[model samples]
Target: MLSDISGGLELRQADAVARALMTDDLLRAGRMIGQFCQGCGGAIGAVRLAMFPSTTRCSICAGSKLLAKGH
Candidate 1:
């Protein structure tokens, strides 16, 4: 679907940003409550939103956070 493509783009962009500006404490994503993505400041995908019910950042961002945490 068209929506799926757009969602992938958003996640890609978020991943790039997270990689560029990542620190230590800001892990596990931002947890924005709307259709927006707190990681890259983009829109959240419907599927991603459904999967990450409590997450603010996309899957990539969440993974990066977990990596930082060593888990």
Candidate 2:
């Protein structure tokens, strides 16, 4: 697959594969975040939860509360 991607003739295939990988990664990340936040006892928002799968806090607490976690 990598060789096909580098050969230049498979640009569309490469793009499709990359997009699929990205989507899969995002879904996996969201599951991880949901699992982590289950007992975290912190406030979270819908948009933040959707966009940032590794985030532990919403925007407000992100800068102050969750930032301490080194994310």
Candidate 3:
């Protein structure tokens, strides 16, 4: 039973670490793109689409781009 408890704790810790790393990566990507949204350096818009989405642009930017292309 103790082992099970410890395993759950470890899993939670791992999840926290993973989230931190992903946040760092997102910030790095946002910096490279040079955009901003809700003060997350543009990550807020892009993160919803997951890890750069289909382009370097954030969701809002991607939508605008699509519109411009008449898609």
Q: Judged by lDDT against the true structure, how good is candidate 2? A: 0.65
Put down candidate 3 lDDT per residue, 1-71, tens digits, no spaces: 24645676544788767777889998898667754542223654545546754454456655675544743
Where model 3 places Cα greater than 4 Å from the true spot, the runs are 1-11, 35-71
The top-ranked prediction according to TM-score is: 1
Q: Assess the local accuracy of residue 1 in candidate 1 as a C-alpha lDDT between 0 and 100.
A: 25
Clashes of each: 1, 0, 0
Off by over 4 Å in 2: 1-11, 35-71
Q: State each model's CA lDDT, in order.
A: 0.59, 0.65, 0.58
TM-scores of all candidate predictions against the true structure: 0.35, 0.34, 0.34
Per-residue CA lDDT of model 2 for 1-69, tens digit only, reads 457557775567679878789899998987655533333455576778678867755566556654556
Q: Per-residue CA lDDT of candidate 1, range 1-54, in tens?
A: 246456765446776566556643244354333556466666667798788766
Candidate 3: which pairs clash? none
- Superior candidate under TM-score, 1 versus 3: 1
